[model samples]
Target: MPHDENSTAGRVATQERIETLEADTEIPAPDLDTRPPSSGATRQANDDLRSLEAGLDRLQTDPEHAPRAWQRFTTSVLPPILFVLALIAAWQLYVVIAQPRPDIVPGPLDVLAAMSQAWESGRLQTAVLTSLERGVVGFLIAVVVGTPLGLLLAEVKPLRRAVGPIISGLQVLPSVAWVPAAILWFGLTDATVYFVVLMGATPSIVNGLIAGVEQVPPQLRRVGTVLGAGRTRLATLVVLPAALPGYVAGLKQGWAFSWRSLMAAEIIAVGGTIGFGLGSMLQQSRELADIGGVLAAVLVILFIGILIELVFFAPLERRMLRRRGLLGGTR
Candidate 1:
């Protein structure tokens, strides 16, 4: 009977310990495991990438594909204006810091006033027009003469072998160096200026066209040959079109040479119907020690250079590059 009572006591103790443990700790509820994002979410991401690629392709291929209207305000108009304002601010700061004598280096305001005076008097317009006309005429002459010469060289192996190096060599020789010979040959007339411009520009244009022709793909030549094109027709229609970029680049450089050559001739060959160009005007300002006038003339020269490059050549270059898909469209 005592053994039975001891066993009952042990059983009661075990039961009490089990109840205490169960009350102290809680059991966790069964739950499902986390799964990844759905297939619809993945499909949405793929569609977005495809849309982006399509937009980029359109930008490359479509000329009329305009950027959003807001981009015009943000990119086309505001940035250049802001940059010009910044440039002016920097000029003002420089003037404040340097404090040079007016005759030595006139401030921006002085140059502006001098330009205003010339503009009001109409001398600036006449002088600028004179320079522009000469430069444009000279450049056109170079293009007319140089393009044919370049093509001849490109088409004829024997002639190119004989004269190609000579043509390139002339490019290194300064146009000013030719001015002395030109004056001796033609005297100080307009002929001398035109001669200098031609000498300066022709070699550059020739070399540029030659380079473009050289870069024309052999595949393109083969294609033209397969189409039963003769040498002249192939070059004119196929190879020349392919070489437009290098040729255009050459034209740009040739124009630079023409402008510089014209300026140099104007400055050095002064008097006797040489005409009053900005270069001559600058020289006169220097002679009189009128720093503002000198600076104003320089500003006008810079403006014209920038204007032509921006308005004419830059657009042409961009259009060519865009058509080739070598450059993306404007943002």
Candidate 2:
């Protein structure tokens, strides 16, 4: 009788504790023997990760191709074309409406007619060819002479400390200022023109080269040295190739300097046995009071500049940037 009474008391005490916990917290009791396996929890986590991986794979696979042809035409081609057309229209309108004195500003139609006249007589072609030949030859000479000098100046700290400021100073000096000195050095001939172009352009090209060479990664140089590359081999295989983009950029700027220098030389050093260039043509047009001819010649000069930049430098620059992956999605 005593053992039965003790057991009943213990059971009643346990039941009361359970009821108190459930009533106080409104919580259900957990089944201790029925917990989820660790592997099942891990499998759920992996399924979530797989879903995330699938999302990433889809993003990478989605294509972002180049613009469609019509889209390209609308965005790229149309704006410039429209701008040029608008400029032409405005010029024509100004001529038609205001009718500026013919000697000062010629009408568009008048300029067109003058262009046709020059073309038929073959003088226009000759002048263009002469100017273009001079510009190209002078630019090539600047590149040849300036590139090595620039490389030296950039790579050699002593050279840079000595001549870097001088180079930048030369860039600011007007190409026209070189004309008087060039004439004194080479006399009034193509030699004088070439000298002026060289003086004007070489500094810019050299500076560009120097900057490019300076920007080459030191880590790359170290890597080359570690790989047993000798001085010449390192420069050829590592430095030059690495610095090519900057070199090309310098070439573009050098060409602009050369063109300007040639124009200055042609205009100031006129009256010789040499044939007509665009600059000389413009000078003659002014003397003859032929504003139409002047405008035509100016347009031709602008066209030449655009032609060279678009045809040569633009593609070259794009290729260099592409090789470095800097321009991967840009086009």
Per lDDT, the best of the predicted structures is 1
The top-ranked prediction according to TM-score is 2
Over 118-158, each residue of candidate 1 has an lDDT whose tens digit, in order, gives 89988788889888988999999999999999999987889
lDDT of 2 by residue, 207-256 (tens): 87887787899999999999999999998899998888788888889988
TM-score for predicted model 1 compared with the true structure: 0.77
Off by over 4 Å in 2: 1-71
**Backbone clashes in model 2, listed as residue pairs:** none
Local distance difference test, each candidate = 0.86, 0.83
Measured on C-alpha atoms, candidate 2 has an lDDT of 0.83
lDDT of 1: 0.86
Clash count for candidate 1 is: 0
Write down the TM-score of every candidate.
Answer: 0.77, 0.78
Clashing residue pairs in candidate 1 are none
